[model samples]
Target: MDPCNRFRMFLVPFVMGIAFIFADVSQALALRCTALSGDDRYSILYTVQAMHQAKIQRQGALITVFEIGGGDPALNGALLYIRIEHNDQAFVWKTGLNVHSIQQLSTGPENTLDIRAKEDFLDSNNMVISREVSYKIHFYLNNDTLEDAIFVENSPKIN
Candidate 1:
């Protein structure tokens, strides 16, 4: 066969193989979080206690926070998220929230008085990076209703 034909065959298969590989990797990273609610602190704290039971849950760096201020105004519910760790350092993707669930989050040593998601800790990210991951909205109680909607979102990529 001509050199042109040989190049076409090799390139086509190589490109297709790469596409397939990426598709599979993305699918594997997909995850889901179940929603739970409670009027008092015990119920809310119980949910977190159950989530952190595993030994090597995400298997990278562990990023955790307990916020006690008004939940960020942009978002309504509380949240927990996981992200891909970068170079064995802080996480790269979602930070502490690459994958997380939220709704009026309350936390306290998994035993002390529960703290709301709006608490200063949860509403903001640590100051290690030049650009900060900001919480658009956070509030302990919604003016309209206590009911909150769980949202699915993708994390921003950093190069």
Candidate 2:
């Protein structure tokens, strides 16, 4: 057998294996929000109390907002669990925001889902230690995913 033939065989299998692994990982990360079982979805909804939803049809994205309520206003303003779904992939982020509204805004190369909220600066015990401020989180579309674009702009906003 030629040395080159052996090298080709090894490289082909190695490449195929890597591809398979990545394919599985990509699938695993996709459709997570939509794939939630009824029980799990209901559990989250029940525990979280208040929920809101918004959609971006152009980007094939859906966003669900869950307000984690119960604490006193002085102790905390709001904690929100945000789930963003684009096609089959979904991204989740948690932040200290009381969502006032959600809006779709676009300009040039940027298509964004803007979440308007009142943000509370809180302490360890969930107390609002500072003045509440208004914030707009802009989630931009990139390559069919809605997670990375907002990560940089909203890093400080997320708890």
Candidate 3:
């Protein structure tokens, strides 16, 4: 084989490999998320109860219900923030009710919640990458608070 032809053959594959790597990186660059749900434990005064229906929706919402009698009634009526973490990215949404006010928090059979992303974080082309992502949820007592309050739940990656 000619030397120039051999060099061309090697160069083509090398360039193709580089292109493939770039494509993978671009896919990773888009924010991807998986569906997640699990139980959250709440305690008031020495009594602890599990909030079993907690869920984080891929579209941008966290839904969970807190029963009235487990803790202080004031705790149920306070405003809260829901924080979601995916890889190094974080998104926050405000929930109108405190920990105890939700009666039936439903994410449906798929367990997906619908949440509105902030205007700054909107990406029209990136779709939620189901099952290929992992996420964590944190609850805050105040909307302006940066730190998670007493409740944090880590969910299993849904297949």
Say which candidate scores most in lDDT. 2
**lDDT string, candidate 1, 11-55, tens digits:** 997886676456434423433333232433233344342132111
- Candidate 2, after superposition: displacement of residue 16 in Å? 59
Candidate 2 local lDDT, 38-63, one digit each (tens): 35444555557566777766665777
Number of clashing residue pairs, candidate 2: 3
Give per-residue CA lDDT, model 3, range 81-112, as digits (tens). 44444334344343322243322333433333
Clashing pairs in 3: 57-113, 60-115, 76-100
Ranking by lDDT, best first? Answer: 2, 3, 1
- Per-model TM-score, in order, reads 0.22, 0.45, 0.24
TM-score top scorer: 2
Please give the ranking of all candidate structures by TM-score, highest first, separated by commas: 2, 3, 1
The C-alpha stretches of model 2 lying farther than 4 A from their native spots are 1-46, 73-77, 98-109, 117-133, 152-159
| Candidate lDDT (C-alpha), each | 0.30, 0.49, 0.35
After TM-score superposition, the amount by which residue 11's alpha carbon in candidate 3 deviates from its true location, in angstroms, is: 0.7
Residue 123 error for model 2, in Å?
Answer: 18
What candidate 3 gets wrong by more than 4 Å, as runs, is: 31-156
